[model samples]
Target: MAEFPRNDMATAQDWLRHAVAADAAGDVAVAEQGFLQALLLDAALVDARFGLGVTYFRSARYREAALELRAVMAAGSADAATGILLGKSLYLTGEFPESAKAFELALTSMPLQGDSLRCYARAKTYATMIAGNIADALADYPALAGAEAEPIETVIRDGFGLLSAYGHRDAAAALGQLLITENPDDVVQRHLNDAVAGRAIDHVPASYVEAHFDAFANGFDDKLVNVLGYRVPEQMAELVSRHRTAFDHVLDLGCGTGLAGAHLRPLAGELTGVDLSARMLEQARRRDVYDALTHAEALTHLAAHAATFDLVFAADTLIYFGRLDAVMAAVAEAMTPGGIFAASVETSMHDFEIMPSGRFAHADAYVMRLAEPYFELLERQATDIRLEANTPAKGALFVWRRR
Candidate 1:
């Protein structure tokens, strides 16, 4: 091996100079060793730590890179370049929320363009899907840390809409708790508070679902179809057409705003729709496609109804449920023998996983297992459900038959 600086008596500056030279000459191993030596000689050397972090990052040692970059940040030596590097390191390690904050800081000096900007946007979108993690509000409002509760509450409630929407649950829960304390009947805030506080919930509460869809019923169609490019209903309708041409009776479970009802109407002799949201039912009723629209939960209606339907389909509805045992059993019981069943689900590896976006994705195996006793699998097709955060959300459509 060539002679290299290994003397304990060598000054930190000497090691740092050698490290910089090695780095410039692309001698990664020597550069890393020199940087470590420089940091050992002078623990407070931010330059040495930054150099080590760059070496680690280049070598794809992301966790090590983050440690050194974080140390540089804590040393008050962070600049736009440091922030960008730190952000990239955190992002590669799947710390999207923290990465977003780092990228945001970098934007103060760096031009708002290129990979950094794209990464920031993607990270921010993913961050919003996360819930239950408390945000350090002090970062944005250091002065408010010691301020009175009244002012903090006011700020969160009145002016922190963007922060709350960004999955900063602590700020949102603070505001929600304040609102709930003042008005006991604020169901919306109560539900939001429960969700962010780690309350046990197998599925979204019916009241919450009703209120949510009711509030959005007016713009639901335009938002899903035009803005989000939602095509699950159209895809589901096509799936049904391939397996069967028509049915004497059809049930559209959780038929929201009549999106699926309109498509299924042509194939049904008598179509019935059921939903938890009355506002959604009102919108569905406007289509005049269903012979009957029942304002009730899908499972409740399914449990009560006899085996009269020859076709049952739910388009873009199963995402609210983390467990399909109860609903699947109810659907199985409600359908006539040899009847068709079709539905769509966001896909995951787990039997079922509650996503950060407050939706559930089920493994294909789980769905097949649930339907095995009651139905024969006809077809399973994977496709993009919709645009979430400007990215295609992958999901599967399943068609089955009652045993």
Candidate 2:
């Protein structure tokens, strides 16, 4: 523990103890005051400054939190934990490129701490995802040294996991770090012990999803439906009403900017939406259609509220996952018994290759194979969703009832 001396008059020890006690009790106002008091008494009290920054962070005042945290760096005393929170705060307040700097600096600390390693790893993966380099993502892997790098490695693994979850790459590449450039000394770290080289998962991995959604968030809706002819949502809605009479809950997975939620309006008692992109979720939030909005990766959101929804809809969102197992399972987990799940996927029976234009297509067989386990296929139809740009795309709308 580092000794932070306040003034010769005030015992730094007493103020620090008070600050820590207040912070642990969730009395951040008291915590902030105590920390500031310490700082006032002793300007060199790095601990108190850090405690003050943390108070702002826990209160969600991220900008103010970052300012005080950054002061720690100026005082020449910093650690991985401070860096991680500060970096996260900076990123959340829309200082994206600056967030990257904070994360990198955290990594430079000798023997990376768990949180710091993970932050940097996430930053790198998101960087790639934002660039839309699906192929390059397949090859990038984090270098993990010890417990300190666990968080970073986790982010890297999750990024690759998302690529695999969405069927962006082959199973072999996903089972291990087969796709990443590596030396002989590198060890492959999978969350599972023997899930095969690319065992089917039940939910989309967090890293790839976070990056892909954020990267595509700005132009996502326009490009997918407008440029590519995405009509999955409307068609799915039509398929549902033709068969079932009522649905209590309607959820849009990867609900980008509420495009699907808008189509689901009439059919929904209440709509709940989730997406990996905060920006896209923000756009959806403005529509006033969905009852609740969450900025979480597709799988985690669905998994957290398992068996609570009556209807789950994913419109043309499955294309991002090369494998349907994890995401489908999440949908299954989230739906009530006898609940109906509707979704769309672009079809391709050929080799899983990124065309010169860079779009992925999966065969209908691949789609059915994944859904058969948890859902009874009630109706599936081929349809086109009219894009805002007036172009139509070919897609499959499948309605499945949970068994």
Q: Write the per-residue lDDT of candidate 1 for residues 360-400, one digit (tens) a residue.
A: 77899998998898999999999999865444689999999
| TM-score of each prediction | 0.61, 0.46
Candidate 2 Cα RMSD after full superposition onto the native fold (Å): 17.3
* Stretches of model 1 off by over 4 angstroms after superposition: 1-185, 189-200
Task: Show the colliding residue pairs in model 1.
Answer: none
**Range of the 10 consecutive residues with the lowest summed lDDT in candidate 1:** 141-150
lDDT of 1 at 312: 92
Best by the lDDT measure? 1
